[model samples]
Target: MIPASDQDLEQVQAQFQALVMPHLDRLLGFASRRTRSVAEAEDAVQEACVRAWLGFAGLRDPAKVRPWLYCILRAVLADNCERDGRRQRLVSITRLEDEHEALVGGDDDAVLVEVEGRLTGEVIRAALADIPEDFATAVEMHDIDGFKYQEIADILGIPIGTVMSRISRGRRLLAGAVASNQRAWLRDDGKGERQAEARRAARAGGFDGGVTS
Candidate 1:
């Protein structure tokens, strides 16, 4: 790769500061959606940012910068997931797209309500903490951070098959945990009936949502 000129480096840094830094929350939200843990999501994004900074010189096409950053974030998440021996459960990025569409369609009020009713940061952190550390790491790296299997394998110094297995297993475990938590919530609350109904709805929507752990 050609070395980035000083001007190029400065421009990259400026772009990161302007466009990327402002999107930290959105990026974290995206990571959390995939990894289901606030801590892991934060870690994944942090690592991704670090990698992006280090590899800024490789990013020749300014237009591709956003996608490139996302790619790095995903790679970091994948690596963490693999190291954690977490089973990978695939989440559809469709919800995010849907939410964006809702916003664009001028349903701001509905979007705000949905956001308000969403899981809290504390809930995500606690759930992540409940998972095995290694599994959490792997899930954050592979799924949330968006690392490729081979890249994760290289990063974690594990076999590629091991990376795949960890992702698969971690996802399964996470889904089971989410199901169990929902059941527990139903049992503990007076609104057990309503909660149960919600769970049913989640299932109907194919929200077999799993995390890295």
Candidate 2:
């Protein structure tokens, strides 16, 4: 049995610091939004980090590190869901492509705009809560995290077409939600307490959109 030398350990640690550490905060935030509990999210990310460190030597390209890390993190989450018996209902995507054929919606920009208006963060998260988790993730990844279609595909280990479909369908659903009740929120200025309560409820349900400067 051959143990890795100190030099090999030092090189790997250096590579990890340069390529992986930069993404730690974002990775934690990503896990936090997806997991049901803070403890779960932290544990999942910790597991993923261990996996990544173990596999660091197999990495072929430093540039692709972001997607690689996400792929590992996602696999951890999926594994947890399956063991907990929630995979069939919560993580299923077998029918997403088939359903993509039925996509009907306006441009992504229009829907994103509507969903990003004042009180829109709360509104968008609220609306996203009602849709499939897979679809919500794609939409939020693109609109909130600024991921490109191909990047999302790599991270999810799915086809680019599926990413497009999820984002499109998700936008359609969010738009409908925003338009249907948008006036109610805008029309009432005296409902500050109600709005705060709504925001609190939203914090419990889903991943928050990142604030773009």
Q: Write the per-residue lDDT of candidate 2 for residues 109-187, one digit (tens) a residue.
A: 5533543565355555555543456777899789876789999998887999999998987776555544544445455
Worst 10 residues of 1 by lDDT: 122-131
lDDT of 1: 0.56
TM-score of 2: 0.66
RMSD of each: 13.0, 8.5
Give the candidate number with the greatest TM-score.
Answer: 2
lDDT of 1 by residue, 42-84 (tens): 9889988888888877878765555566668768867876776
Candidate 2 contains a number of clashing pairs equal to: 0
Candidate 1 backbone clash number: 32
Each candidate structure's TM-score, on Cα atoms with residue i matched to residue i, is 0.41, 0.66
